[model samples]
Target: MTYSLQTKSIQCPYCGEQIEVIVDCSVNNQEYVEDCSVCCKPIIFSVASFQGEVVSIEAHTEDE
Candidate 1:
């Protein structure tokens, strides 16, 4: 499988800061974690993609 990287801007659920995230477009649907750039808190990511394109994305805090 090819690794396709897609960049997305999302608001941090914790600090409400806009952050850029790199998504793996090769995956159809994926859930992952990443730290916030501003707050350094763990972020939960829900990503949806199809055929190397991102359909939708959602960001949440660790508890949410």
Candidate 2:
């Protein structure tokens, strides 16, 4: 089975630009680095989900 999870839009802490972040794990828990749509800087994203709902979200710089 598959389910679409909720998403939240958050501004980049570095550049203060808005970006859409999807926190879905319908396939599996995922971790990756995606660039800001405005500043183009990389943001490390860690997401966890359970029972089709997001359990946790962590975003930070890779250098940290």
Candidate 3:
């Protein structure tokens, strides 16, 4: 089986700027931190997937 990565645009909670993130569909669950392209603030990313499909993507700040 092969897995394909996906891209999504989300708003930054700190700066309210639109940013793009890549998601790996092969993993069932993943969590990581990435800096905002616009604000340079660390953003926590949470991704949930099942059967090579994405269930949800959540973005949060350091405080939350």
Candidate 4:
């Protein structure tokens, strides 16, 4: 079996700057924290996927 991930562009929740991120399609659900490239703020990443496809993605601030 072969798994292929996806690259997506999203705006930072703090600075509103667009950034590119890789999404793992193998994971049905994923949550991680990453720093915003522009603002350097912690961004809580929430991803949901189904059938090796991304269904939804959300970026939130650390305090939210």
Badly placed stretches (over 4 Å) of model 2 are 1-3
- Cα error of candidate 1 at position 60, Å: 0.6
Residue ranges of candidate 4 with Cα displaced over 4 Å: none
Maximum-lDDT candidate: 1
Per-residue accuracy of model 1 over 1-64 as CA lDDT, tens digit each: 5799989999999999999999999989999999999999999999999989999999987787
Tens digit of lDDT per residue, candidate 2, span 1-64? 6767787677776698778887666845778888888888999887877777777777777777
The TM-score that candidate 2 achieves is 0.74
Q: Candidate 1's error at 51, in angstroms?
A: 0.7
Q: Rate the local accuracy (lDDT) of all candidates.
A: 0.93, 0.78, 0.90, 0.90
How close to the true structure is residue 6 of candidate 2, measured as C-alpha lDDT? 82
Q: How would you encode candidate 4's per-residue C-alpha lDDT over 1-64 as one tens digit per residue? A: 6685998899998998999889888889999998887888899999999998899999998889
List, in order, the clash count of every candidate structure: 0, 0, 0, 0
TM-score of each: 0.94, 0.74, 0.87, 0.87
Residue pairs clashing in model 3 are none
User: How many clashes does the backbone of model 2 have?
Assistant: 0
After superposing all C-alphas onto the true structure, candidate 3 shows an RMSD in angstroms of 1.4
Q: Which model scores highest in TM-score?
A: 1
Each model's RMSD to truth, in Å?
A: 0.8, 2.0, 1.4, 1.4
Q: Tell me the spans in candidate 1 whose CA falls farther than 4 Å from its real position.
A: none
Clashing pairs in 4: none
